[model samples]
Target: MNIIPILASAGITGFESPAAEYSQLGCNLDELLIEHPSATFIGKACGDSMQGVGIFDGDLLIVDRHVTPTHQDVIVANFNGEFVCKLLDIKRRLLLSANEKIQPVVINDFDTFSIEGVVIRSIRCHRPSPLLSNK
Candidate 1:
């Protein structure tokens, strides 16, 4: 289980107004960039297999190769040379899903399975937009 620590910084408040000063806050961008390298932006999830988990179609998924896969976490993997997004169920030995309509895929043998990476974040657009337009 790979866990990343996230620190919250306090913002500076102005004397006369409620606005905060942005210049005073400092972020360790270098450390963050080093740990989270080589991010692959997978454009849109098409299938309903992950719908019960709140991951819908046309949602942008941020896949980080740096993080290790853990139980119950959603991940993108290459199963039999095909890319698939599913929940990682390393303990139960089955990739379980909240949606009963879509059957859970059991990973009976670990040797046959290889996790590409765990999903770090998901970006969803409120309005309709093209994922990538040729024009």
Candidate 2:
């Protein structure tokens, strides 16, 4: 898909006239990957299953769908019919945990589970504290 351009409009003194200006903020996936080979754009992360791994809510995960999932690799998978992210333990047929609080989930039925992609990177934003006020 091509990059969707944003146009800026400026109002005229007498009447509001439409004006167009190209935007530089937005980018196309093809152009971005070409410029940065290590970069991969996937869907947003949900749930706290991977919080210990520094992947929190609303984080954008860069998953290389082409990459083969290995032991301990964080992967996006389709369990039954729902999508989930977890550590892959191919040998033991289990999903390991980076957090002690969360236990490893075993794959008793392989037919019900399917790996979608391997997580390559995670992106998060730092938000300013709302409670703290300036004097």
Candidate 3:
């Protein structure tokens, strides 16, 4: 979906005041967030394994297949035929877990270990919905 650009300021502030004139901020969120929509897929974070990196359980991950996997990039990869998300160490060829308790996964073979996509963005809902929340 195409997003309409909103008139907003770029600077971060503790207080917000009424704008004198409404004008485009010269940017759109959809345009900035999404590069290739067709190749991008959404995945839900399942556990606290990535909590150190702020990726909590139930968080939505924006996976972009078009982007090239790089060093220290959070990625969804096939580890021994199982799909998992972890930090990629390209030079060392290892998958590092965010949680300190979990041991880093060393890449044995490049064939079986395949990168699905790079995690472009992460989304979390702070507020619970009325339907799901118990009063």
Candidate 4:
């Protein structure tokens, strides 16, 4: 995570009138969002299976391989040859899907299944894409 110095002091407000006194040094996103940068990787979500949990398709998932996944934590796992993003239910030993329509994947053997990483955050872009014109 690369961090840059905060240049501007005044913050642009939306609702009310802007305040005269503004705090210096805006917080670093890398310091706030990520813990282990070496183990962190980003993956684009491909399906709507996690939409119920606010994780939609085309979202960018920040995964940390160093973080040990606990029960009920959303994790990315490799079941056999396929990669799946779901919640871990350690007590029942099942991979729970956020979507009710989809059935939960059962973890039969620990040897066959591999935990790729835990999804720390999900980011979605709300702004429209810039139109490209032919020269």
Candidate number achieving the greatest TM-score relative to the actual structure: 4
Q: What's the CA error at residue 111 for candidate 3, in Å? A: 7.2
**Candidate 1 — which pairs collide?**
none
Say which candidate scores most in lDDT: 3
Report the CA-based lDDT of candidate 2 relative to the real structure: 0.74
Looking at model 1, which ten-residue stretch has the lowest summed lDDT? 16-25
- Residue 78, candidate 2: how far off, in angstroms? 0.2
- In terms of lDDT, which candidate is stronger, 1 or 4? 4
Candidate 3 colliding pairs, count: 0
The sequence of per-residue lDDT tens digits that candidate 2 reaches over residues 15-132 is 4333333335456665564333564446677778888888987777877777878888999888878888899999999887667788888888655998888887786756633432
Summed over model 1, clashes come to: 0
lDDT of 3 by residue, 70-133 (tens): 8999999988888899999999988999999999888985558889999999988787556433
Candidate numbers, best TM-score first, in rank order: 4, 3, 1, 2
Question: What does the lDDT read for residue 32 in candidate 2?
Answer: 62
Report model 4's TM-score to 2 decimal places. Answer: 0.76
lDDT of 4: 0.82
Q: How close is each model in CA RMSD to the real structure?
A: 7.3, 12.1, 5.0, 6.2
Off by over 4 Å in 3: 1-29, 128-135
Global lDDT of model 1: 0.68
**Which sections of candidate 4 miss by over 4 Å?**
1-14, 17-21, 128-135
